[model samples]
Target: MIDSSANSPIVRLVGVEKKLGRQKVLKGVNLEVRAGENMVIIGRSGGGKSVLLKHILGLMQPDAGEVWFRDQNLVKLSEEQLVPLRKETGMLFQNGALFDSLTVGENVAFPLRERGNVNDAEIRSEVTRALKIVDLPNQEHKWPSELSGGMRKRVALARAAIARPALMLYDEPTSGLDPVVSDSINKLMVRLGEELNMTSVIVTHDMVSAREVGDRIAMLYEGKIYIVGEPRDVIESQDPIVHRFVNGISDASDAIF
Candidate 1:
């Protein structure tokens, strides 16, 4: 939807391959995520979507191939070397992953606190701003336990974006929420991408969310990128595999177990 055709890729994966135990997860997968665009990744459960994201974050390295973030190849970087680069990115886990012991404000301030550059007043101000952006203004005193599932997610989002990372990675952000909550989260994601000037890589199974938030969608299937295109192009695809998955149509033969 956004004109990212002229933008250079902020993330690039070339012939990326990975294996867990005996299972080959990624097979020569290639993808390009342009700066300032929202890229949605969709695939079946346990289909390596999370694995692919880890590679981009340099949390996991591929058995073969290159994972490039900007001009640096993440695959070749030592953990020490990857520290600064990792700081430039934000990630929201599937479970919201908030610390039960920390208050909402403390949780959101965690990143800036770790950096140790911002003073207490600045951290408080940044926390307030991030929480406002996620639509949970003045919720600083609440504990994670006191909030609803959606609220927890919003808080986690606030924490992730507090540092204003150039890239944001989301893992099944709407997994357990109700439809209404899911829609709200999707809207917040779009708003954050615009307001923060972030390039996002979202891993999700929600077709509606994908279409609404993605400038482009890429489907990972059988250990490779099955297809990538605009929302309409992918949704209206004639390929049987894509059609079946997108339309939620199931065939008995698809069950490999």
Candidate 2:
């Protein structure tokens, strides 16, 4: 559980702005993800949700303002300087991003291998525990091609959590999943956040999953965070803009792309 009064923010974006080509994605966005809390970022399709996640990961630098992880300013760090900080964070891509050449076990164990200190015995043990956490115990030998979409997502979750990073970033974790599978994934995310004591930032448009996993929900609209509040408050919002979004009431302007 997160302490609402906690002053520590594991990640903080202050006046962040970004542009891809001529279109601006993030426009002076400011947000704070308190340590050990689950923060869900929700918005319409192509609304810069994934771009925001990339900024958090230091995979993309903001054109202006600052992105801070703990005391380190990510925007100021070089790739070499960012390595240790990157290791302290884990991310689940929207597509699972598992290597097709690797087995499930190998995939889960990739981080450990990259660290290069853990022995095979410890890697096997940690892999087993990680897989079990995702409820995929003893199925490591299977290739990515052999797994269902849901199973692939679960394996990706296992791999993301195996490192026990201080922070986790999930991009569209429940996208393309059936309702049942999405719920299961949501539960797993919550469980993993608790077990790992991680601060999580999940970028997704799924309100059900957002309500299920987020301690706080932030709605991104027109390149800004329109609101940040508890799940009930955001979902039950009376504002027309938020209401239209949360209730899926589309506007003609929303059809612009």
Candidate 3:
């Protein structure tokens, strides 16, 4: 379905296919993430979740089909064209992806520094502001090794928002965290999108995170979007893939390959 308005489609993937060597990571994937809306994509591991996020962020180019961001078809953009787009898109990696060599302040300031023209004092101020937004105001001086897993994720989150991205893409935001920590991450995901007026797309397996953060949820199954709707509707959707996935029934496509 075509959404005529540019604002209606912040991210769109049409018949997109990606392959890493001989392995096909995405097969005819069709998806959309609307502006200022939070969409959580849920599926089994290796089900093309992160692959989709990477395409949207310009971190990865698809082997076939189109990946569109706003009015630009991402597949057509060169690395230089993608640079300005990077400033509008932020990604939070699964492992928090912090630089072990840098302190929290430096990590958060890295993006702005890469853009140049800003002095150290200005970068420091922005870093502090980002940290405060994530509720870790004074941890800027600490190294990533010095923080707990949840804290590290928060620091990474601060870094992601440091540049004020128009689109925020998350790869398994609550992965490798305790239930308490996961809940905190979930809250932050929701808060960032709602409180900051951002369009977000999060790839996650945590059902709790899906329910907590998604304004709408999409189920990626066997290289296609099996279902998309409100979180409750998706869970209640009786399509085999949706039912099996929602019920945690593996060995059921026994899901078709």
Q: Tell me how many clashing residue pairs each candidate has.
A: 0, 0, 0
* lDDT tens per residue, model 3, 72-190: 99889999999998889988988888999999889999999988999999898999888887889888789998999989999999899888898998898888899999998888877
| Top-lDDT structure, candidate number | 1
Q: Which residue segments of model 1 deviate by more than 4 Å?
A: 1-6
Query: Which ranking of candidates, highest lDDT first?
Result: 1, 2, 3
The weakest ten consecutive residues by lDDT in model 3 span: 248-257
Candidate 2 per-residue C-alpha lDDT over 1-257 given as tens digits, one digit per residue, 9 for 90 to 100:
87654558989999999999999999989999999999999998899999999999999999999999999999889999999998999999988899999999999999999989899999999999999999999999999999999999999999988989999999999999999999999999999999998989998889999999999999999999999999999999999999999999998976856
Candidate 3: what lDDT? Answer: 0.87
Q: Provide the overall lDDT of each model, using Cα atoms, as 2-decimal numbers.
A: 0.95, 0.94, 0.87
* TM-score quality measure for candidate 3: 0.93
Candidate 1 vs. true structure, TM-score: 0.97
Better of 1 and 3 by lDDT: 1
* 219 Cα displacement, candidate 1 (Å): 0.3
Candidate number with the higher TM-score (1 or 3): 1
Q: In model 3, where do residues sit more than 4 Å from their true spots? A: 1-7, 252-257
